[model samples]
Target: MTEEGDQEEQTILTWARNYAKKHHWVLNPDEKKLGIVIRGLARNKQKYGEQYCPCRLRSGDKEKDAAIICPCIYHEEEVEKDGSCHCRLYFRKDALSE
Candidate 1:
């Protein structure tokens, strides 16, 4: 990865970490998984100009696609019910022990 890519990924990771803190959640405990998700987010931000969810397909509609960006509209419910979001990025604190 180029230095630019590295920087972008770091920025995303920081944002994600802060977001998780605010929500009282945690990032995926697996470092490999966390890196993958961060890379995906960075790639999307570079390619489509938005941090689209790596685990989902985009509809090609900006307004509709906005819902799938990094902190997607579905994340809360997913975390609340499944312990983690679909992308496995954000997890409930207790979920890590399972």
Candidate 2:
């Protein structure tokens, strides 16, 4: 949500650089939006589900390591991140129950 020349944009870059340090994953190509983005292949199911994991290193919390608080990332507070246009973000219980 920052304009090109705005200082807030610069601040966002600082945040982005920190996000990049999280892992070795490179920025994905479909990434034309504002922040850092990563991409990978994922399976889908009819019912969409989302969750936020502890990997998101928000400012100030002692447990820095990743935790399995939630299984999927939602786009609102989170949303199912896009892998490719063809893939839907969900898991079928019958298929997932394995």
Candidate 3:
């Protein structure tokens, strides 16, 4: 990745970490893997005008697809039930101990 891309990834990762911290959640601790997900988010933002989850297939319906945007509608529920978001990007800190 170019320096620009690396910078963008770092920015996004910082934002994600701050967001998780604000909500008492935690980002996946694997820096290499997190970078991949953060890059995917940046790519989605460039392509679709939103940071849709990279793990999900877009429906091509912008309105419907909005639900899958970063911090997606399903994430809270997924994290509550599964202990982590569907992409495993954000998870409960307690889950890390298990």
Candidate 4:
């Protein structure tokens, strides 16, 4: 990857880490997979003008789709019920042990 791409990835990772911390959540420990999802978020931000979750299908309605933006409305519920968000990016630390 180019230096620029590397830097962007780092930035995204940092933002994700901090965001997860704020919510008392943890990011998946698998760095390789996390990096891929971070890149997807960056791409979505560039393409759609918002960081929509890459794992989700866009309905093309900006208002409806807004809910799927990073730290989507479903994340809390998903993490609580499924251990991780649908994309398996952010996960509850307790879930890792189970």
Candidate 5:
């Protein structure tokens, strides 16, 4: 990755960490998984102009696709029920055990 890409990934990682801290959540504990998700987010932001969830496909409609952006509309419910969001980026504390 170029320096620009590295910077972007770091920015996204910082944002994700702050966001998780605010909600009493944490990034996935596995460093490999966390890096993959963060890098995916940075790539999407650079290529698509939005940090769309790396785990989901875009529908090509900005309005419809907005729902899939990072910290997507489904994240809250997914965390509550599944212990983590679909992308496995945000995890409930207890979920880390499993």
Candidate 6:
């Protein structure tokens, strides 16, 4: 993935972390004094280059394309194509009041 893509993914993950914290969800197992909640998710990276999967990009299903595509590419979840959906693993930090 490109630098831009990595940055974007991090940004989204941050939001998810905050969202889970707001809902009092145990995103991470460890805890700290400041109580800065953290959320984590597994991301899939295929070994084969010729293989294709949603991990390359969200294609709205069709992830189980080929065995060469590797297994468990990004926590597979059905996201809406409405254009505004941040995705199931996504959460906007500003979604809740600070």
Best-fitting candidate, scored by lDDT: 1
lDDT by residue for model 6 over 1-98, one digit each (tens)?
56754564465456556755664432322244112211112223222223233334434354444432312233222221221112223222342222
The runs of at least 3 residues in candidate 6 whose Cα sits more than 4 Å from the true structure, single-residue gaps closed, are 28-98
* Distance from true location, Cα of 36 in model 5, Å: 0.7
Compared with the true structure, all predictions reach lDDT values of: 0.97, 0.27, 0.89, 0.88, 0.95, 0.34
lDDT, candidate 4, equals 0.88
The Cα RMSD in angstroms, rounded to one decimal, for candidate 1 relative to the true structure is 0.6
- Ranking of candidates on lDDT, top first: 1, 5, 3, 4, 6, 2
Tens digit per residue, CA lDDT, model 5, 1-98: 88999999999999999999999999998999999999999999999999999999999999999999999999999998999999999999989887
Q: RMSDs, each prediction?
A: 0.6, 13.9, 1.2, 1.5, 0.7, 11.5
Q: Give the range where candidate 3 is weakest over 10 consecutive residues by summed lDDT.
A: 1-10
Query: What TM-score does structure 5 among the candidates reach?
Result: 0.97
Per-residue lDDT of candidate 2, residues 1-98 (tens digit): 22523444354345434543443222222334323221111101111121123234333332432232122233122221332111122222232233
Between 1 and 3, whose lDDT is larger? 1
Error of 4 at 22 (Å): 1.4
Worst 10 residues of 6 by lDDT: 33-42
lDDT of 3 by residue, 1-98 (tens): 77877787787888999999998999999878787889999888877878899989999999999999998999989988888998889989999899
Better of 2 and 3 by lDDT: 3
Flag clash pairs in model 5. Answer: none
Model 2 stretches astray by more than 4 angstroms: 1-5, 28-98
| Ranking of models by TM-score | 1, 5, 3, 4, 6, 2
* Model with the higher lDDT, candidate 4 or 5: 5
